[model samples]
Target: MKISIYREKLKDKINNKKAKIAVIGLGYVGLPLAVEFAKKGFFVFGIDIDKKKIKALSRGNSYIQDIKRTALSELLSNKLISFSCDYRNIVKSDIIIICVPTPLRKTREPDISYVVEATRKIKDNVKKGQLVILESTTYPGTTEEILLVLFSERGLKVGQDFFLAFSPERVDPGNRVFNTSNITKVVGGVSKNCAYLSKLIYSKIIPQVILVSSSKVAEMTKLLENTFRAVNIALINEIALMCDKLKINIWEVIEAAKTKPFGFMPFYPGPGLGGHCLPVDPLYLSWKSRRHGFEPRLIELASQINSHMPNHVVNKVVELINSKAKHSILEANILIVGVTYKRDICDIRESPSIDIIRMLLEKQANVSYYDPYVSQLPIGKKSLHSIKLTKKNIFGFDCVVIVTDHAKIDYSFILKNSKLIFDTRNVFKKFNNSKVFRL
Candidate 1:
């Protein structure tokens, strides 16, 4: 595989303001990438199959809170960025970056259908001197096994006629500290030239560009980063549970541990791990490892612990409610605070709050939720809408459960108003009263 032409084109694209770039799958990752490239003076085409996303982007309305309206308006007015569902525009572009979702199946298997379908779109419009970089997070060998096999059918050859690389998207939704332009991007190419060009393209936008040996290493780097997070979160969650049994505050322990400053980094305990990347990425690696007759025991164990968090929270809720009064499980008014997967973000994909709400309903608890960012959340058969989080509303609930610890929620107000509080996120650091129970 050779990519001399692709390397030259990439260098030209980096310096040329008119060089066209097409970003496929305009979700959290793609939309931001498109905007950043446009801001850097490149003609960016944002493509997605969903007409709704295209329509919204056309009107300059963004679904992600991280993307400001003023920035999007500037990009739209300059005509540097465009949105479309058409594939013809993709073929017109010099560089195409795939940022589609790679979710898991029911059996926790890697589901690359989105990647496959998007790659097929690229194949249909693929031309010579095209550079295709996949920015989606997936198992190792996905670029080689899934995409390379299909591209070989075109007979154009990778790295020679067309360039290919795998660059994982490190988009942390709602994170104020890191954004597309600042985050260090990792890129690996099929060949040396392919990697060089891949680095050249992203280097224009990002502050630091890290290059690995191969595309597989770049793929595995993403999995390793997410898996480490999953395991550490699991360990902290286990400690929080043990602290409950021993009648100690986990928050204090974490704070004291942070003072060590040498071998310590603090990770908070929550109801469970949620969000698209941390919970889903590990399963991709675990499934892929099986092909080599290897099982990731650590990954599996962490998953089990993370998955069981909702159950642990629900049990604590039940115990707290039962001890309060002789009321039946079906009659208690349960209010769940913070519905989004994490704090301050509207994205609720794989949020453990959904699981907690479902389990509560199954146990016959009358569950109502409150999230400032989210209006309505779909859990099983019911569309649980967010009630106003106020002193009056909090006064009516039998017990308020803290699922997501949004900064907007007044912890003191909640601790004072609710009859009893089940603090799963440990947000109420100052509350020492008997009415508050930490899970």
Candidate 2:
């Protein structure tokens, strides 16, 4: 009877546009989510520990690439959203969403300290008749084991006095196709009331809301999604290496295989896997699996292959310099184009281009890079700036390697003036020239 009354009250607040929504950890995921809710006519509070982010948002500015500045300014003008670095705002919010990052430690173990700490802050200000949902990705059983314990310690009767759920975030940075409004959101909770209430809140802003049986299922769903990508990427990368020895272009083979359209999904080969999801999410699952005495052999093997790709690229550079250029690697003037992890983004987290640049510098090569999105690289112990992409700059290098293929670059200008080119991303597929090489 008590659970029904609380559920009705929450549902009424959401339907009438009176619910005060709070989103914690305003980052790539949280900022867009908070904006989406505000766009849907709900009052929102954007909370984070970073004062710089809060200050910027308070001025009607957006730091995330996916969110537009005009939309943020409009929300601020309408008084639908506000930013804060305080946790006391959570007490007044009827629904709270956690969107903190779950990164790996230096030892490659799952570092869930951010999630745990966020839960502690939430517990301190939680009130009855409120709903809490976690959107950070982690191993299975994290919501049930870690978050539930914290709420329980507060003496709140969940499903009656409070509601808890897990809804993993599927944020793809720099992806223009899918955003927060259209993507399908999968939600799981500790009880039916929890799942229903959480689904109602998300349904107001998202296109689809899927309800699962338990929070553990939602957590595992996120891991499986990324692990599948990591494993397939490793498979295709190994195939690319083999294609090099067989004197066949892997890109050509992939283009032909993609014609069948049934049993094949094209996963491209690059220097290696980068970004927050592909390189880090798989290890979280494998680490958890090992605790139960189960060996995830496939996951480990994929990680090994992906991790060694930077070295493979370095070896290719050495071979190219030895066979074509007059100077050794120690005396070469190598230029790398594009340093970000992927194309058309400014984020540099776990980028393979950094490792490739470090390796080239270790061999005494005079290396310089040019990226239109990134103006400078502040790597460890050394800082390099992006050089201009003129004919004079192109002609001065021993070879130019295309590490990332941003659309804004003038590739024809480089090809017309460069002496030799090593293309890791197959950016020179249209031109047939003796000076161009593909990986």
Candidate 3:
């Protein structure tokens, strides 16, 4: 078939809800996206290497907090969406989206192995006239440099025999307002037809589809968005440290500055930068910049500041314990309020609470955690479970550190019971008490 004819056929299938949409890696990003596509009347297939996730989805259950179980059950019952561990589904898909993770290595460099592995699977099973879109977050030139080479090596001509594009996944896991269907989708392709086909597919489920000039542009767009967040968060964290030394409440200062409403956007300080995006994405940009003979000093510095926050929090805990408790840190019983990276979410990937727990353990402190969302914490070799937050358990601890300010926690109960409270998230700013120490 001619290239134009293939493009027109794919576009028609997308518009008429007849396209088989396959989403690879059904974790935080892929599950919600696959559900949205299926809800819009598209036949969606979800692929994942984790058998546990496959089994759960096959049984019409959702592991992700953002994806409701009822919604997933309805789609599974209607036969609009299916789950699989086999790569054979790629052959039947008209549009395939790769939502695999792009995490950092131990050396803090971009680990594109997951993206590469998923692309290789697509290269093996993909057929002619199929559209492949990379939704994984990575450095610039990934779609063109990595994916384009893979397809070309398989003797497939992109934009002719098959379509190729990059559309960054803008998923905020615990966010209630903006979701997969509401957030604007940004897409770019190696060729105009590739971009157009991707935009058509996303427009069916998304509110808006932004078409960029090229795939590299779309990749850089994601990096810029997260890098902006990382940099500003580091700036605010440093200010909070300064405010602590000067005896000024950083939360009050932020409130005063936020009233301007023109130039300043408030970013609260925390134990550290956590989650899948802020801590990992900026380093991908910095790593790519170093390859081109440019060092991203600001980004590197921001990472350093944010990385030190866990230590800073640990130091404050020690200081408060030394001053208030009759016993040293080694003998003190410490309790952590929340272990997840953010509030109202169960995701603990790259959470700074893990680092804080490790630091406290090294100091020989008796540490326990209470998160309504997370039930267990698996460290290097030991497994810690969440303790029940009773009045006796609350008062028994010498120090209670609020790492993640989850809304569901009883702040009044904590304030009335705990001996000394270290508020890393500034949750007790409104209540002025001698026992509460703000970070």
Candidate 4:
């Protein structure tokens, strides 16, 4: 059969609501995306090697806060979406989107194992004219270099018998403004046909769809967006350290800078860059660049500055504890207010709070934390669990450090109950006294 005839047949299936869409790796990015597709009236199958995750979705229970249980229940009741751990269903899927995790290795390298594994699983079952899209955040050349080779080995010609495209997932976990469906999606394909077909598929769900020239360009777009934030935030972090020495509030400086609203764009200073993207994604580009004999100096410098922030905060804690005549770290109880990377949502993928706690433990400091949003934090080197957040819980800690600024936390209660505090997020609207210091 001609490729165009196959494409037309697939289109007819989709129009008739007969196309089976498979979403691989049902995690933070994948689960929400699967739900969106299911809601859009597609027969969606959410596949994950994690049996527990599959079982939870089968029961219509959502692990992600953004995904409503009722939505899952509706999809399940309608028999529009279901979860599975089997790869045999791949043969029945008309379209497959890879939404696996692209994490950094211990050496700060891009680990594309999950992406590769997903491609390998689908390679054998890939039907003629099936549209395969990758929604994982990865470096340029990933769609071509990583995904294409796997399919080619299976004797399918891309853009002919099958299609391949990269559409980077821009899912912000807690952001109210953007979600899977409304966010502008950027897609690039290995060839012209691939681009057109990919855009057609996504245009059904996303409000706006942008088609880039090639897969590499689309991949590069995601990297540049994150690298821009990483560099700018590093610059502000440096300025914040200087302002602290000069007794100037960096938050006020940022507020004044934001007033122009013309040439300047505001990126605030924080305890440190955390979460999945800003902290880890930039390094993937930098790591890939090294193979081409290129050094991303700005990215490297930014990583250094951002990574050093937790240590700086820890030093401040040591200084404050010593200066106060109350108790030393050995006798003093230290409470870390938030454990998640950013506020509101409970995702600690690359959270800097882990680094802070580890450093404190190395110094023999008794450390405990309270994140109402995150009840249990995975202790890296220590066995300690999340501390309770109560008035009496606050009394035990000699000093508290605010790593994340959750909107739900009662600041008035903390201020009255805690002895002292080091506020990394400037959660307080107004400076009250010496007991509290804003980073």
Against the unseen true structure, what C-alpha lDDT does each candidate score? 0.88, 0.92, 0.93, 0.88
Q: In TM-score terms, which candidate is top?
A: 3
Clashing pairs in 4: none
Can you write out model 3's per-residue Cα lDDT over 1-439, one digit (the tens) per residue? 2357789899889889999999999989999999999999999999999999899899988988888899999999999999999999999999999999999989889999999999999899988899999999999999999999999998988888899999999989888899999999999998988998999999999879999999999999999999999999999999999998999989999999999969889999889999999999999999999999999999999999999999999999999899888679996899999999999899999999999999999999999999999999997799899999899999999999999999889999999989999999888988999999989
TM-score of 2: 0.98
lDDT of 2 by residue, 214-277 (tens): 9999999999999999999999999999999999999999999999969899998889888788
lDDT of 4 by residue, 1-439 (tens): 2347667777777777678899999988999999998998998999999999899999999999899999999999999998999988899899999998888988889988999888999997887879899988898899999889889888888877888999999898888878999999999988877887788878888879999999999999999999999999999999999998999999999989999959999987887888778988998899889988999899999999999899899988888888873567665678998889998898987788888988887788888998887777777644667776789999888789999988898988898888889999988758577799888
* TM-score of each model, in listed order: 0.97, 0.98, 0.98, 0.97
| Ten-residue stretch with the least lDDT total in model 2 | 1-10
Point to the candidate with the largest lDDT: 3
lDDT for 254 in candidate 4 is: 91
Ten-residue stretch with the least lDDT total in model 1: 1-10
Which lDDT tens digits does candidate 1 get at residues 3-84?
3665676567667765689999999999999999999999999999999989998999999898888889889999999999
Off by over 4 Å in 4: 1-3
| Candidate 4: C-alpha lDDT | 0.88
TM-score of 1: 0.97
Pairs that collide in candidate 3 are: none
lDDT of candidate 2 at residue 48, scale 0 to 100: 97
Residue 400 of model 2, lDDT score: 97
